[model samples]
Target: MKRAFIPPADSLIAFECAARHLSFTRAAEELHLTQGAVSKQVRQLEDRLGVELFRRVRQRIVLTDAGRLYLHDIRGALENMTAATRQVMSYAGSADVLNLAVLPTFGTRWLAPRLAGFQKRFPDAGLNLSVRLQPFDFDEEPFDGAIHHGDPVWAGAIAERLFDEEVIPVASRAFRDRHDIRDPADLVRVPRLQLATRPLAWRQWFEHVGVETDAAFQGARFEQFVMISEAAIHNMGAALIPRFFVEAELASGRLVQLFDISLDQNTAYYFVYPEGRTMRPVVKTFRQWLMEEARTARTNREAMLPR
Candidate 1:
């Protein structure tokens, strides 16, 4: 089957722009062409299609039925093509990746639950997360931002306070039964599970209650809060855990607090970004979303606490 060759691509582009805008002058302005040049291109396009694309009147122009239908279809196709092109370009530039670092326990027990909202808000952005054991060189790891626990004082980074971490002693039902823990002093008799990240937790809590214990350093050491809490749940020993992290387990009888004693750690969790890069669009967006998530987590944890 033989067919006539198509005309210049610019003519179809001119026709689509003019038909969509319903004004050759406006389309020409957008296309960086004069009105006369735009009109000529559209006319050439119509001639090739063997149809009138616009009906000219005294002071204005309008589309015929065929022109209206063609505009609707071609405008959609052009918009779709433009969007796809931009997406590909963005990927090529590596501008679509959001690299994040977070503490392992907080990432699982706290941050993981609230991430769907982040996904909903930034559907086009790719989120990549890494577990951070301690504050490190952000440039060395190539991280866009990180969640850290401490005094919002990460060196060479902009820190936004996210939440306060307060620890309270908790034990399994059996652990409490085996050791009579009516007062904070009784903690000395129970085997305490310790977090390697915060070595002085027991000392801080005991000092708050005016109790002293040499056994604070004697216990099973875990690198993460989740492991410490899980070990406590299995009746391995008592653990001083962030009250917020184990609220569900406490309410469901999976774990129980040995006493009402709670101590506020001097340090807190923060959202940290490169010192001079906090104002970047993607970093700003992720910071706002993460803060909102932290607020929600704090609210829920507060609601679950026993008064």
Candidate 2:
């Protein structure tokens, strides 16, 4: 049997710190160890690997070619180890903890309000929510599952479709009154608020509504939908936002739909997790509850819609 190669933890930590700072003294200060102690640890690591990891240049030090490569791999490994340790410890202390990642605006505007029902259903389960704007490797991130947007293209994961997104252009009632946006063509003349994730959103909306304009691509871009929505509400510009995200604002008449047109998004929101993995009891419970809640929400919305 081939023996596993496990480098000394202390030596690896010292080397990582020293490599990051590029100075033994700074690494020592940060690690609360003497400079000599840190240097000795690095030296021990180099001897074990039979490689000189650093090049001394007078008063300073820098990583050698080999050191740079080693640092890249070691840093990832260490981060994974730290995350694993935290995960294990959290599970030990609270077995019901469910680590979930979600988009910022979706979490705040939609999911958060409905989470109380989830809590009520699964009172014993502990839920942790963190913001993740884009897709990521499930192995690298500490999340057990994520609320994902876009295509179900996440490799090695099971993506359960939650709901499709219908987006529409909205502006503050004051802005609408000011611009007199009676026709979709009038929207073309106004400043548009863009979300960074959907750069071509306005163009798509315009095309769907059969309005061709150069202004489709012209707009102030924002990273989050919330920012764009705020800009619209404050009369900065008309924003294309998911209908569900701005339900409250629309209901309160803070913003008005520029047109009755709704564009069906190519991508949708999903509840995703690593494939072929045994789900924790808490996760299973949450998954079932979330699906039921989504169905209930869709039913309620359908009933309220003009039939």
Candidate 3:
């Protein structure tokens, strides 16, 4: 079906590149074309759309409100198209391709290592993983499923629990020694690292241990657990991190667990897929394998805990 409202693909490419750099010359250099050619393509695209995308100011260029909105939607379309092309180009004899979106740190640490087992179990199946920090619309994205870290809530999706999140306070041995921290209350005066995504992490951890402090809200914030782990390793501050993530550091003596107390988050990690898609052979097999892995991991964790 031909859509007259949609501008030419090459023109969209020109517009995207020029809008990104705000300079036709830069866009031309990247696209391996002359500046005039890029400008002509963008002008044609604007004419077709009947809207001014870019506005000039003192020889520089900036996107108009329409340009910004178009860029926001088009960028994702381009990336998804690129991903689809790559998936097709890289295809082998695999029967089913599983496209998954996962949390970055969790994907790197947990699922990645266990992937060998899945590959061996289903040698005929292919798996692709992409990093996604939060929930997204499944319809708009080219994903078969996603590993979500929060609540069991996704529209038109089936949520299966992967594991519970339990976070504990940890710090470098040197930091602990320098601060003379012995009890949960002692942490209030020292540098505390905060997770930017969950600002209430420290407050909740403190409350779990029955420690009161107004300073829980004050600290250097890091966006991800990996960053917080690195900062804490350098003695930047004490950080509250998921226990599973810091096991290696704790064993290596790089980071020390502060107290036995931990905060059990109300939220848990979940493997979610569109409800109707569960009937697919690939999705069903993966769900079974994931639940098994989750059970094994949970068992091991519980076994190590003091009885």
Candidate 4:
């Protein structure tokens, strides 16, 4: 496809908002511009496309099929442009800005709540959260530090051990009642829901319970742990997920432990920074606060266990 000359960024932005809300007036309000200005941008964009994109009915604007398709493509491009601009702006100045790459669920459940304390302690520092899907070249990225899983072997970075990991076989109480899972071995007979994030979770859980089941690989596999937990809660299957994520479900009787089998991942979470970044103030503050938070979490998790 020929790269058609795109409209101005502001014009494309206005068109996207208008297309999404299906209202130019609303888009104008969001953009903090006059209705006439919004209309002008849309007209500019439409002219650039040489196509009739929107239908002006009695008092409303509706998208044509062409408008919908263009909106989809342009919206994505506009979003990417916005993100790139933000990233560039963020890294412009100040060593006090701490950009942390974190695991998605772990960041939300464990790290995010403690960030307020970190902010209060280092008021001048700006804490930024970036999600790490898999191991990447940290040096090439603009991140200040990363809270990565596994050992301290990340090339071109200084990795400090944070905390060990654990997973338990869990399911909804309703699901437990419906299925005959009296023993850990019985889990093999049921649908074994799997989390794509932790590919080896079930195998470790089975080893803990002294079971050798190849069907561990079978069942629905979801990318996120939270999704797997939800599927388990809905009686989809048994999921071996991190203990922290399902605390509420376990306490509220929404989910239950199928067995006492708990296996350690052995590899702990690590606070990793680019090789030459040990003296950075923001990175140091973040690492200190994170380690303190991890200590608290370990104590709390220990207290919650049966005596």
Candidate 5:
């Protein structure tokens, strides 16, 4: 019969703390144990595993290759355990918990403002929000669902369309005045801010507007729309930003729309969840409520548009 191997919880905890801090003394301080005791625990763990998990060079402790791999798994396990404990405690208290991942800027600008409605409707349901700037494996993470942008392309999940996205060129009023940019063709003369993920955004915008320029591929690149918006507001450059994300800046006159042209890149935001997983009651209710909210938003936006 094969024997199952499980390290003592205390030893694993000691090792994890030691690995994270790279100093037994710091780990001991955090764990409320003596430095010698922490060192003893780590030594015992290494002896049992028959490996040197750390090496001391010039009195500085550094992790070995094995220690680095072990630390990664231990951290993941600890996080899972913590999440499980929270979920069980919530269940025992008769509360519903929904773990959701969201795009940072979208969550802040749009969903956050509307969260009060969801809270009012289901006060007992606790919504745990985490920022996920990009798509990740649904099976690997503990997330119940995610609010995704770009496309409904996440594998192993059912994507519910939230809204279609429309992007327009925006810049600080000072930049426009300084550049004297009166037409779409004049955009090529100034620097353009780019989103790292959407590398060809400027090119696509120019193509849609039937204007050609080599500067489409030039300018500073950023990872998120928030950064791009900030750059635009500071007159760093013109940026192609999603309309909804920059509404506040536009309203406040911090940013000016350089052209009336908008680009539809055939991508939209989605609320996605694992396809085969059973939906928790809170998740189901939230999904229905979110869909209804999207519908209402679309209607209101269309109503405001000139005929």
Candidate 6:
């Protein structure tokens, strides 16, 4: 690699730290160097870049227009480098380190509990997890694979079906009793809780249960299922929630299922990785384990639901 365009590492580090603190003295204190040393480093960086990164006005340092733009980009680059280093540090000797992204709620509620088994099966494998709510490009991110929830369409990645959801309408016991929700159609009469991401969720649920009403779209919208579940528990309204997510609530009697019929989110959960990544040992091992776990989960779910 050509080194001509690259600024000195010490210069970049010093400049970035000084830019953040806006004080050479403070930056020096943080770096455990003298203020003069920090100032000299910044001067050398400015000379190399051929642009004034900091300006002194009223005896205080501030960023120039070019400085502000460069700082923004450099911060991102530094953060990415730090993240890459951390991911590398996760690896040991010949142990495989698999970095996987997953939906926040699903990772916590569904996948977390079952992860112990994966560790047991693959003692030499390392797993690093990050939360992702939507589809992402594997090339742009450092993730080896991701657990996605949507249609099996991820541009350059191949998606392996994980499991679909079984959504049930639920509400606090008090709310259900007060409203006397006897059937699936009774949900339309009450204030229905909705998800901001899944705006048409209620309408789809109604369509699944063969119930038609104008009130389907009207409700208090929430950003996440946890919030919606809490709203339902507080007697806010009936919420259509995935059964697995509310198992504790249902079991504890905090919420009750109003109907036996479940809405299948046709867009199932999937384990996706970039093309050609299946050749990697870590990716392949985790994928097989996850697929088997998902199959077992699906089978158990199917057996329990009212037939």
Per-candidate clashes, comma-separated: 0, 0, 0, 0, 0, 0
Error of 3 at 256 (Å): 1.3
lDDT of 6 by residue, 158-215 (tens): 9999889888889999999998889887888889899998999899988888988988
Per-residue lDDT of 25 in model 1: 96
Off by over 4 Å in 2: 1-5, 101-104, 128-161, 173-180, 196-200, 233-235, 251-254, 272-280
Query: TM-scores of the models, in the given order?
Result: 0.65, 0.80, 0.81, 0.71, 0.87, 0.88
Judged by whole-model lDDT over C-alpha atoms, candidate 6 comes out at 0.88
- lDDT winner among the candidates? 5
Q: Give the Å shift of residue 146 in candidate 2.
A: 4.3
Pick by TM-score: 1 or 5, better one: 5
Pairwise lDDT winner, candidates 2 and 6: 2
**How does candidate 5 fare on TM-score?**
0.87
| Candidate 4 C-alpha lDDT tens digits along 30-71 | 999999999998998888879978999988999999999999
Q: What is the lDDT of residue 118 in candidate 2?
A: 81
Q: lDDT of all predictions, in order shown?
A: 0.83, 0.89, 0.88, 0.83, 0.89, 0.88
**For candidate 1, lDDT tens digit of each residue in 1-307?**
2445555768878988887788999999999999999999988888888999899988788999889988887778678778657544555544576778988888898888778887777766766677886898877776889888877777898888888987888999988887876788888888999888778888888888998877788899998889998899998998999987887798899999888768887888988888765466666777889898888877876876798
Off by over 4 Å in 4: 1-81, 88-95, 303-307
lDDT of 3: 0.88
Give the C-alpha miss distance for residue 207 in model 3, angstroms: 2.7
Candidates 2 and 4 compared by lDDT, better number:
2
For model 1 the local lDDT of residue 29 reads 96
| lDDT digits (tens) for residues 1-307 of candidate 3 | 4686777889989988999899999999999999999999999988888899999898889999999999999888888888778988655777988889999888877888888888887777888889988788888887889999888999988889989988999999999999999989999999999888999988888888888888898999888898999999999999999988877899999999998888899999999998765456776788789999999989988897898
